[model samples]
Target chain A: MNIRYPNGTAYHQSAKRPATTMSQTTNYGDRGMSLEAELNESNQYYLNQGVAVIHKKPTPVQIVKVDYPKRSAATIKEAYFRQPSTTDYNGVYQGYYLDFDAKETKNKTSFPLKNFHAHQIAHLRACVAAGGIGFAIIRFTDDVATFLLPASFLFHCWDDALQTDGRKSIRRSAIEAHGYQINPALNPLVPYLNAVDQLITATKK
Target chain B: MNIRYPNGTAYHQSAKRPATTMSQTTNYGDRGMSLEAELNESNQYYLNQGVAVIHKKPTPVQIVKVDYPKRSAATIKEAYFRQPSTTDYNGVYQGYYLDFDAKETKNKTSFPLKNFHAHQIAHLRACVAAGGIGFAIIRFTDDVATFLLPASFLFHCWDDALQTDGRKSIRRSAIEAHGYQINPALNPLVPYLNAVDQLITATKK
Candidate 1:
């Protein structure tokens, strides 16, 4: 029943922040909240306000053994991951099936291609083919900046990596040009949905 | 990482059945494939054909202990469910956010309301309010029949339970009248999406 991080830190839901100009004074990296945590909180806000119905898919685990110590409670004794997951988050937005993964990188110049897996790439491709909106939310942790990179552009980079012995990362410059930059806000925090709106508009063209 | 069921049976992906009318000869329940498994196969079929993108959310497990004997593999030693989950499956289908759960019951006359949790009902309501398509796929195991019951109708029944205290379960006659019956098939197995199409059309009307 008690959930903790690998380091044994108890995982408490992130506290709601005041909608004010605390961004200049507060160091977000030092705030102890991860990009995933912030996104979850923002999704909660969206859900509560009837704006969107998005959710982070749970980490899939294959249960091996269960101990029924009591009739009421059964505890899992052993398990392992079934496979590498497809994406971190997916749901409906304005009748669009949105599929995306959020990744944080310390590298300043480029987002490493190695951060993505083949399975995830394939899953995104499949989603896009099925008329779903697919993208990656890349957060350059060092600069506290994030970009919403469309899956179409990402596939191009992925294929380019396979065809040639070029850099295995999408350069920061390329991301800035092709992806929509997401500014942090008080209420929604990342406000990545704004970027999604732009992407939807761009697709219409 | 071998996975076996609680009864110590080895887990195997449900085999693709031949396109034959074996319903009269073959006993599906005895074939060891649960309704969930059938739906998974059907979803896989949909994915393979580039029809729609749907996935069953993985069961959320709160890991209490993990053994990292090797750097490559980590085995969860102890864990438990954090909370009751929302629904079994959710994804985007042809520009619609599809959210639903699959349930099977032994009762012949009615599909018991007790099969659904309060949290799931609330989750469905929230999804529907956010413009997502929500429903339940109820299977009568006695007759081997499945029906898609829309969230709108489900909410009415849920509220009726609270107010009038009528029969807690939806009578089989009511489900037949309000819900779309899904005929089992070879390629998609359950072919529930056909029922989804019906639901979509009904909503349009």
Candidate 2:
């Protein structure tokens, strides 16, 4: 089906339909959507269900000039993208502050640490220190497998990367061992909050 | 002295220095800044002190066209402002999810309900429902007084406004009765977190 996102991007959903009557077991795969698009759809589902209140922050832009015509809406004539100072997505979930960024990599064996910015890591560290739950939602595009890595683990790996003899990227095996795997589902696409519940319970312990 | 904001707006701090040696007794007043500027300064102070991790979401804009010249960054040629779907500011403070927006009005007797958009009210209601502390920092520009009105009280006022015979605005007297007043300070500009601590204590009660 043809769909248009709020930003006016044209998206086409996969036409392949499940043959059986069972809907719960149906896997949607990636469905030709970016990781961000999937997360947006998932966040919308959660909002509608009153399960949580999360949203992806808009891309920051620096506007240099605008044209205000007498009878029309003001139009930005010159602008440029600006580096964000925090994670891409953050909100409240069941009295816990949720903060995270989504990253996708095509590498089959590892997720590169260079995908994250220094400011984002600092911001997440600050959030975690202030008693908020922070994490990274990583997707391996080769197989569409996703994982939620807690900020504490990410911080350890990040600090290791800064060491003189540390490896450049985190190994997939290490991520699978330390992170919570989030399987793609029929509803909410990426059911990551189920994993967040685990993190909260573990934190309490 | 002329100071430039990240957005390139020039701001001038009041040159008149506080004569008293007691800094705690010093009131900075508005300091010739917008309510947003004061809040930004306060949030920075909190961040530096590791007290809270709050941030104002960037203004959303819809980009229609862009031009990418060689050897330089891409420039937005056409764009328009998009209405935000949530509160302007949110973060975690002492294990509690805090969500709020800042508003200013010059009215001497009452604060007009028209200053708020329906989506903002709905968003605050949803955040509060999700067990987050939601509020609005309202500044009366007439006397430079500010107050923090809780989402529960705002919901009452919003619903009352919807009634056929209800008043369209909240009187200053009513706000002073229900909301916590925030006095300006030299360190953070707006020492609003003291008021927030009170809100948390009351919530626990």
Candidate 3:
């Protein structure tokens, strides 16, 4: 199960200096406004309206060596991924705990299984068991449609990895059937907060 | 009132790394453990014992410089806190969504106001309003005791920063009155999950 970027875009290796967007760094990945930036803007919108509380998790970077070039802006010349994070955002929306991962895939038909790691799958499983609403926001770039797939379905697919003839992706039809479709909006950009509102209302009943 | 660390050690900028029991690097202002390590470990423990599910967030690091002295190990020489983080940890324990900050202070009598940033306070406010169990764990190193103070309490103390002769720290009495005290165990370093159990039991009853 290999999740391939549009044009063989590998995991981005950050540079010493903040250059351009990931697309400019490498066009192979079909990268755009980083998911981090979009979520941040969305969070700001949530804050302004007093609607919901949502935030993107910070990437865990293990700092190794630092260079004091001028006493300001410590240059992290060496670092490593501390640990693979479980999800992208986890907070309270309305009156429930909202935890999810937002990911974009260039594939038109299915989301590649390689996009998620085993640890992340385990995390979602535990979160769901503990009663938090765990889900994933999968963006099918080809159709430009995003769907909120509950983590339970994702975990079941992940568990299938143990099977002999296991598949490698979640097809579009499956998402259409099980996931809550999300459309982008002006103020919040991702407009996921609205979906959260809907889910909360539905779940309460 | 500001909450102090156990030792009454006031927060002072680190001229050089203090040889304390830290993960890698930390400062007088910033608590160590990268938030990721702590959460990952906490998550692992959650999975093993079926306690809770929680994870730390990912943030984009504006990497200024990097030196690949060797192929295997890329050293980050420069990096900056890109955006203000919302909180340290958020997950579901039992049937409640929990959001909190895990902070360590060396002060014995009171915890300082400077330890928390403006954004964190704002984020906690939103989480609390949304009905999540939002609070913070303050470690007083001198007494080796960690207290779980509610976000409501935090809002009052932090907002008191400008009261002109305002109480800049949360006294031990206040924490004892309003916070859930956590005692670290061998398995979980922070053992906050236990405190959550107490909170859940009380809420359920």
Candidate 4:
């Protein structure tokens, strides 16, 4: 039977699709693949190299109905996405607790503040308060440029946006001034850890 | 349409069941509640009090089909469990990364090693290597006694079990000797963090 995803797109069952084929299908010249896919591949590379232990939290779903054909396996027949209360990814890296989310926008001039939710900002604030490193990986899809924006810098912009009639989105110039640029690599597509190392060094200073 | 769970129990659509009634029906006299439920409640308490920010990762499911009947809410029509590569819960607490799994067994004298998968053990080992705290909160269902067993001790037992003709499960006496016993309380319900505090102190030494 035909099915649909939450976004109203038709769900195509790609059970037999090879991993290499899926990666090859991305329009690399313009988009260079999705930010999420790049991060996942980079994380796998880091894991294989024994550099870090990071993982994306699974999407939260509320199961309403399930079917059991036998005793060993059960098939979920009804479920919906539950709003998540935390960031997308979190894990231990080089004896540090890292919490962050990745976002992509086709907008060339600025990264819109609407990409973040109040609850997620609150969570990042709490993480920082508890001494964990919190940051955002913002990707300007138009230029394939990504920046590791520290939570503190984001928080400042968020509060400023609320108090004044200023721009709600962070300008590209401001992000370049405050955030560290992450260079893409062959082995690890998005070498975010290098930006994280800079974050740690800056924190120490 | 009727459905069943992996345990062969029919899934009763409890859309209208009151929360209080569900908690009351758990046969609380002999067994207070499932270890998972108690931990979730305790985690909520911790969050409410600003004590810690720990959360259980949602159960992972591989969705094969989803139906949008009227183009509003999507219902999963076919999904199955995916083997989890990490522990059930992980979060940052007081600057430390904590990862653990809660397990319950009716066996009074020993906690079977079979309850843990090789992948989980490997994941825990990796977490420890990355400088995060890894552990198991084991509940002896018969006596309702729970202990915080360190992953280091668990690793030793796992390696020894494979190498020799030794008991595959940890003996009650051994756990009592090596693990920190967690006392349940009213507010936090599972008071496991106090045991965690002790674990942290010992790590410092």
> Which prediction has the highest lDDT against the true structure?
2
Q: How do the residues A1-45 of candidate 2 rate in per-residue lDDT, one tens digit apiece?
A: 443322212223324433332233323576678889999999999
Model 4 residue runs over 4 Å out of place are: A1-32, B1-31, B69-71
RMSD of 2: 7.7
TM-score of each: 0.86, 0.88, 0.75, 0.85
Tens-place lDDT digits, model 1, residues A89-171:
98777778899999999999999999999989999998888788999999887777889999999999998888768679999
Instruction: Give the TM-score comparing model 4 with the true structure, all chains together.
Output: 0.85
- Residue pairs in clash, model 2: none
Query: Would candidate 1 be rated incorrect, acceptable, medium or high by CAPRI criteria?
Result: medium
Q: Evaluate candidate 3 and give its CAPRI docking class based on DockQ.
A: acceptable
Question: For each candidate, what's the DockQ?
Answer: 0.58, 0.67, 0.45, 0.52
Cα lDDT tens digits for candidate 3, B85-132: 577677788767778877777787889978888878877887777777
Better of 2 and 4 by DockQ: 2
Q: Model 2: what is its DockQ?
A: 0.67
Model 4 lDDT per residue over A1-205, tens place: 4432232122133455433334423334233367898899888888788888888888888988878887678888888878899999888888888999999998999999999999899889887887789999999876688999999999999897887786799999999999999977787999999999999999999
What candidate 3 gets wrong by more than 4 Å, as runs, is: A1-37, A68-71, A197-205, B1-44, B56-60, B65-77, B197-205
lDDT of each residue in B1-205, candidate 4, tens digit only? 3432222112133455444334333323224367898899899888777777788998888989888789587777788888997899988889898989999988989999999999999889888998899999998876678899999999988997897797799998999988999877777778899999999999899
Estimate, for each residue in B1-205, the C-alpha lDDT of model 2 and write its tens digit: 4532222222233234332322333224754589999899899999999999999999999999999999999999999999999989999998789999999999999999999999999999889888899999999986789999988999999999999999899999999998999988888888889999988888889
